[model samples]
Target chain A: MRDAYHEELDSIGEGLVEMARLVGSAIGRATTAILDSDLKLAETVIEGDKKVDDLQHDLEARAIALLARQQPVATDLRIVVTSLRMSADLERSGDLAQHVAKLARLRFPERAVPQDLHATILEMGQLAQRLMAKAAEVIVTKDIDLAMQLEQDDDEMDLLHRTLFQHLIDDRWKHGIETAVDVTLLGRYYERYADHAVAVAKRVVYLVTGEHADDLQQDIPPVTRVEGA
Target chain B: MRDAYHEELDSIGEGLVEMARLVGSAIGRATTAILDSDLKLAETVIEGDKKVDDLQHDLEARAIALLARQQPVATDLRIVVTSLRMSADLERSGDLAQHVAKLARLRFPERAVPQDLHATILEMGQLAQRLMAKAAEVIVTKDIDLAMQLEQDDDEMDLLHRTLFQHLIDDRWKHGIETAVDVTLLGRYYERYADHAVAVAKRVVYLVTGEHADDLQQDIPPVTRVEGA
Candidate 1:
């Protein structure tokens, strides 16, 4: 049986998974809210961000307290420290989801996305939500393969983002400058959301393998150095 | 006499200050690069970001090692954790600066900011750099009042951001949709740069006061709770 101290450590990791789940569902619902101009759903997502923030703050306080009380070293120390970083990433992801919902609220009864672009925006949203879901799964299972997969999903997100820009710059666009501005901002919100999800997965990879994801991907050895005096 | 352990903690804080200074100068140069379409200057900013990343990785490793070796409690512990967070903010701020430079490089000989909008963009860039300088100052001094001042600067940044949007949506916008897109992204990069700078200052305030900046901002007493079983 695990001691109480270890249980506390386990709880911090569990909190991260729960936070990721909340945000993953949030992006999915937030995407629907924006596309449909559902103010009610948007309101819930915006209000729900507080719960994510609170979880982070609580987890942070507990993590520090654990360090003070338990003083676990080596791998245990790395786990607690990494958990803090993961929580920060998850909290930021929640904020990005809220930004999407807030944009929906800003547009009110009117749709934020233009009709022709809705399909692309929807695809971006769905892909972003999938990325976050997989990130959460990686957190739970610590499967390095699952963590690495987020990069390809992010590349897909990038392709969709480029498609969005192409549509914007195309001469066929009949939308006014205001609509284009909204669309531009919306595209950014989704892209940044996906980036954060990928970052979370990378952190998991680092924790599991003791190597940076980019270093592993590019076959570059991480340099070892002592800080110069 | 202060021991080696405390000196190590002091060095971590110093490293953060150094990072803030590097990225602060980067934003200033990137602003010039974009305004003048100077590929050379933009290249320097892009390459310099690697230095910022190196500093962060080195600092993080040292921090984790220190946590393992020192096992600080209470205020000392908070300082180390907050340093790690502040380093992350500075590193991200560096990336934002590099994004500004990349935009400049992408636009090449063509200025990204059209003739009419140059003043606003320049102001945003200057304000972002100033915010980072002040944030660095706050990290070193931990002056509560100086830390509080970042909020006002951030407010100014938001106003500038809105002005950029206004220019984009102006009925007389003759620069076409492509320029509008570039301007929109530029505004976002600057605004986010300022936000990260403000975040760095707020973390310093949190470390010094043991109170969250937002909690203090609105006079909201932070809630106390015991985790439910």
Candidate 2:
């Protein structure tokens, strides 16, 4: 019975990994669809959302069942809880990607984004997607360095987001009220996407370190120690 | 050993309830301070934040210890996890209250708010504070109806938020940018407070029903059903 329990637990981990892969694919396709203005790809990403939702529900049920039947100890409990949280963040990330794709399809050159802004947005999307993928990598491999690097990657996304904001606010583009709303909502979606990735990274760090590292204060460079000091 | 574990768990619950009470008081004091421009009450709310923080950290430690040592089963595990999530929401609520106080103190009134908007804001504050207080009440009393009421109460805050936004955009006051920023931030804080309360209510519903309530769908008015149907 114990052997069977362990087998069940291992399969749960496998399910989480598979779900992460699909989520990552959804994000990748969504971003590509936005950049390429592919309506077909946008529709595909939207359709894919139901699968992610189903997987998330399945994962939650399995985790609860493991808790009920296997009576997992401290580490196993933590693992299940972390998996559940990860699934939530991954699902949100997928939603964000779909949101971005929907915006792309809705606008389709009608929104009149500045040409130069597209490169920055594409950069932001790639970085956010990579950070999410890295989170999954850390979860599977327990890679501390990879997880640590996510914070820096997120900082880059933040910088890009600010730049994108500046682009929208500039006088060169006389974006009307509706277009401005579109841009504002799109920018918020990207920023929130990056935030969910950061959340995933923080969870990964906690799962690996077994200690909360959520106090990663932004922008205030931590007082560095000198050798003499 | 088992008896000691039970004692500690019970104490953790007590601490969480106390934390919730502090958060509730902070929201009340902050809202009053903002509405009345009472600098003293603002200071009190700010000073009260440390207690919330301390309780939060203590509860986190206790929950972690309980999980590690007690190895609790289904219901007990749910209790510990619930405590952890509750403390997080409570801590955030306290932080929002402090933010409102800070904004109030920053823009100490040279004059009182115009009567109409003042009444609206006061209404919003009361509703938000009441919802937060009821979150604690429902948790302690296990009153599912009270929790359900909070879900309804969130819509009031939402309506007020919309009204405030519309009034601001109308620009009747000719308020300067700083004052506008203050009011906008204040509105956001109240909206977030209601959001946290709704979150807590959802948790209660989950605790009682063993199912997640779709809060968005819950907004739909129920129609009469024929017994034959």
Candidate 3:
């Protein structure tokens, strides 16, 4: 019975890593689809999101089943609950990628990204992919240091996000409002994608360290404090 | 013991309603702050979010404790797990409201919404608040019909979001890129806030009916089917 329980836990972890990989490929393809105006690729990425969503749903069900059957306590309990949340973060990351693909499909035949900003968007996409890959590694290995580094990696994506806005906000901006809206939404999608990756990594940090990432900063009190009424 | 467990479940439900009310008010005030350029009001909303955050943390801990102590099965287990997810949705809604307040502070003294779009934004904000209030009602009453209605209400927010984009995409768009970005982000914040509200309502639907909200839409298949290996 114990062996079966451990196997279930391992399966959940594997499912999360698989989800990360799928979403990472998704953003990469979605980026290329936008940069190259490949409508077919965008459609493929959009459809592929169903697989990620299915994986999340399956993982959640299995986790809940394990909770009901095993009645896990302490660290084991935390593992199941946190896996549910990590699955959610990864599922949302996939949705963000799909949104990118949908945007690409929306502007089909016309390049959504202008030539000058293409490099920044491409870099942002690459950074997002790397962050997810690292996030997956953190889930599998439970490497606290690697998990901590993902947040810093997210800062790079943030800088790229800001750069995209800088281009839009510059006085010399020539992109029409249509392009501006497209770029604004695209930047936001990538930024949010990176954020979800960071969130996944943070969950791993908490799972391993028993401390929330935010709690480490000490800027605010611990999130779960029970006081006598 | 059973009575104690039921009371704990009721407390969790009440906590969710409280969270919904706090977030609903936060968005309403944040909207007013932006529309009126009231910095003090914006600051108040921003600060008040801490209370919402703390409440969510407390609720999550209590729910998890109940799970551990009661080892609840079936509906009871589902209730605890779904409450956690609902709490997350409400907490995110609060964050979206805070983002609105922060943006208002960022553009201090300068109005975030232009004179022309004020009515549209105001309408979106009100719709978000109303949707959240309805979500709170759904949580307390577990009214599947009302929960189902939230998706339609969310459609109004989506339409308002589209209208903002239409204005931005028009050839006559005179708002500079900075204001354009601000407006774009603001629209997204409200749109996402409504999405979270709908998510909370959907959770209620699932909890009551044992069917996911998406499953009701025949366009998509059930989200969790494992293929033959």
Candidate 4:
């Protein structure tokens, strides 16, 4: 009976890992769709987001049931609680991706973002995706070192965010206000995506260290300080 | 032994309520500081935020200790978890208020935001504080109706957010791009403050209903649609 119960718990863990993968992939596709102005990909991401959402709800229900029935203790309980919080963050990441897809759909082939800013956004998205994957790997493999490294990965995203903001403020492109708004919002979304990825890493840290690391100094160190104007 | 444990839990719950009250007042003071350009009030909020942060950490540690020592089950476990989550949200709300205070500092005596926008911000801040207060009330009383009502309150903040965005986009002010950025950041901070308040209310919902509320949903009933550009 104990073996069977352990097996069930393992399956739930696997389910959470799968959900994280779907969320990570959705974010990547959504980012590509936005930058490339690919409506088809954007549509695909929009559709796929529902899967991420469903998987999240499924995972939450499973975790709650585990807590309810299994009466998990210590590390097991922490894993269940972390699963609940991580799933919420993942769902929000999916929502943010949908927001990006909607932006792509609304603007379409016109490419609301200027060409110069695209590279920065692309880099930020790539960094976010990588960090997310690392987070998932840590969850599956229980790699505390990888999780620790994932925190530092946010530095790249913050750098890209700063660059994107600087471009928005710069005189080039005749200071296009509308695209600037889009760019700023996109930067924020990517930054937040990376943040959620770091949050996953923090959970892993807690699972390993047996201490809550949620708000203990953000994963992303300051890449560049914004001088108060 | 059980009686002492219960008393400790009660004491912790009381402390959470007091922290909530402090957070709500901080929001009020921060908003007043913004509107009145009361630097002193802003400074007070900034300083008070550390107390909220300290309280948040204290509450989390206490909750964890309770869980570890008491091995609470079912509804008791849920309450502890809800309190933990609610404290995190309240901590973030304090951070958001600090962000608003930072905005106040940026404006100095000049008042970067126009008088019209000021009223909108004040309204948003007031609504957020009220929701925050109600969240604590619900937590204290386990009042589902009050919690549900707070969810609806977030709609006003969303509407005000959109209105503030439109005003910024209208570019009626001659203060130039910096003004726009500051206003945008200010609006973003207040909008997020409202989001945290909604988050607290949602936690209350989960505490009562054992299910997370759809936080993206603004108003509860008629689905009042705000015009989107």
TM-score of each predicted structure versus truth: 0.92, 0.74, 0.93, 0.88
Residue-by-residue lDDT tens digits, candidate 1, A18-110: 999999988988899989999999989989988998999899999999988888798889889888988988888888888788777777788
lDDT of 3 by residue, B147-196 (tens): 88888887777778778877776778888887887887788788888888
Model 4: share of true interface contacts reproduced:
0.06
User: For candidate 2, lDDT tens digit of each residue in B1-229?
Assistant: 9889889987977886787788778888888888888888888998898888888888877876787677687777777766776776777788778877775666566422445578777887888878877887877777888888886788777777777656554636455333443455566667777777777766766777767664421211000010110
Candidate 2's displacement at residue B215, Å, is 3.8
> What's model 3's TM-score?
0.93
Which run of 10 residues does model 4 chain A get worst, by summed lDDT?
Answer: A216-225
Which is the better candidate, 1 or 4, if ranked by DockQ?
Answer: 1
| Model 2 lDDT, residue B192, Cα | 70
- Share of native interface contacts recovered by each model: 0.48, 0.08, 0.28, 0.06
DockQ of each: 0.34, 0.16, 0.30, 0.28
Q: What is the Å distance of residue A55 in model 1 from its true position?
A: 1.0
Error of 4 at B186 (Å): 2.3
Q: What is the Cα-based lDDT of residue B24 in candidate 4?
A: 91
Q: Please give, for residues B7-37, the per-residue lDDT of candidate 1 as tens digits.
A: 8998998999999999999999999999999
Best by TM-score: 3
- Kindly report which residue pairs in candidate 2 clash with one another: none
Candidate 2 segments exceeding 4 Å error:
A1-3, A22-50, A91-120, A164-188, A216-229, B1-6, B25-54, B92-123, B164-192, B216-229
Q: How many clashing pairs does model 1 include?
A: 0
Sorting all predicted structures by TM-score, with the top scorer first, yields 3, 1, 4, 2
Q: Is candidate 3 or candidate 4 better by lDDT?
A: 3
